[model samples]
Target: MENFTEVLSKINTAKVIAPQIDYSDYVALDLSIDNEELAQSNLQNAKEYELYIQRFLDRNKAKIAFGGYLETRNLYQRSTVFKNLNSEERNIHIGLDLWINQTASIHAALDGTIHSFQNNTALGDYGPTIILAHHLEGFTFYSLYGHLSVDSITNKNVGDVIKQGQQIGNLGLPPINGDYAPHLHFQIILNIESNFGDYPGVCNAGKLDFYSNNCPNPNILLKIDNNT
Candidate 1:
């Protein structure tokens, strides 16, 4: 069997969001430790961090603020879900984020069936998340859409067929979307394990190798130009 990464390399029709966004409109955002701007700002709050992202997009004249795969973020410190005495802090982001306006439509990256849907309402967690099960070229994988509006999972059911580019839901606002900015946390899961509607989008430093292998880079399917 081909590895998940190799299978993704052959895919040419993965659209994680609306197709109207052109390559020129995408701005690669840096929230990692390398970004000096974020290091100086107080990004503990979701709203405040959201404003920073907005300012960046506006300043760059771009519509989307993207990137953040395996980025070490300090913002997760605000939520106990990520940091606790029982375990090490989980700050490494394992997905690609698309920072756009609130209520923007989210589409299926590929043809798949709804595996699970739930409103994972916790501080700094995935709100109204959906997981899609897909099979291509004898490979089975899953796609996770997080930080979605409440209405997104209202009528959804398990095993529901979803076509590529089909409207899955819209991006949720703060508080509803785990108290963060309106953005879609899109991740590709090679193995979902026992997780239901929610999966770990962030991992601790120690588990980087395990999570990195389980969650392949979403850009392999989206094909978005990180250089842009």
Candidate 2:
């Protein structure tokens, strides 16, 4: 069996995040819905996460920001079982959420063509999303960016090549951004069988193992934290 790590290691390091954005403009939000306080936590507490993102924007208005790792969540994974719990309940989060108050210019982390894009209009859905495909390190992978402004895909077509750090879209606001807060849902995918526009940002308890491996830590390629 081909190990996923082997594929990741083969990714073209030179092409990934070449025009890296400053971390000062972005903050980490919930990555998993593992904790009760945050998992079942209401949107009111979104400020905590939003604020973190805002601070990054406040410092670097012109630069892009990034964060939201496994440690970004209250729970260990993103599971519906957790979401079914009460506010004090612990849940898991699956995606890395990048925070920025207004619609910050979203860029492609690498050179890739648009695989799919859609407006996932749902209370907790991605609202607006885009997925790109790229071949790196002898392996092909996909990157999903969620909670984007509806206009982002106004005239974009599938297979369109987006260069690394190229402005692809901007962030959307609440009510349109899944009602959580203003932020972007960024995820690195290995084999995306189908789930277009939106994937399981949160997984069920039974499939934890599957998701953990299928969706390797995005920071591995993003290298968001150079200081650490």
> TM-score: which candidate is best?
1
Candidate 1 local accuracy as lDDT?
0.89
Q: Which clashing pairs does model 1 show?
A: none
Q: Model 1 off-target regions past 4 Å?
A: none
TM-score of each: 0.96, 0.73
Write candidate 2's Cα lDDT for 28-98 as tens digits. Answer: 43343454544443434445556644554565563444554444354222323335555333333455766
Q: Which lDDT values do the candidates have, in the order given?
A: 0.89, 0.65
CA deviation > 4 Å runs, candidate 2: 1-21, 24-68, 71-90
Residue 204, candidate 2: Cα error in Å is 2.3
TM-score of model 2 vs. true structure: 0.73
- What is the C-alpha lDDT profile of model 1 across 87-160, one tens digit per residue? 99999999999998645888999999999999998899998999999999888899999999999998888999
Candidate that would win on lDDT: 1
Worst 10 residues of 2 by lDDT: 10-19
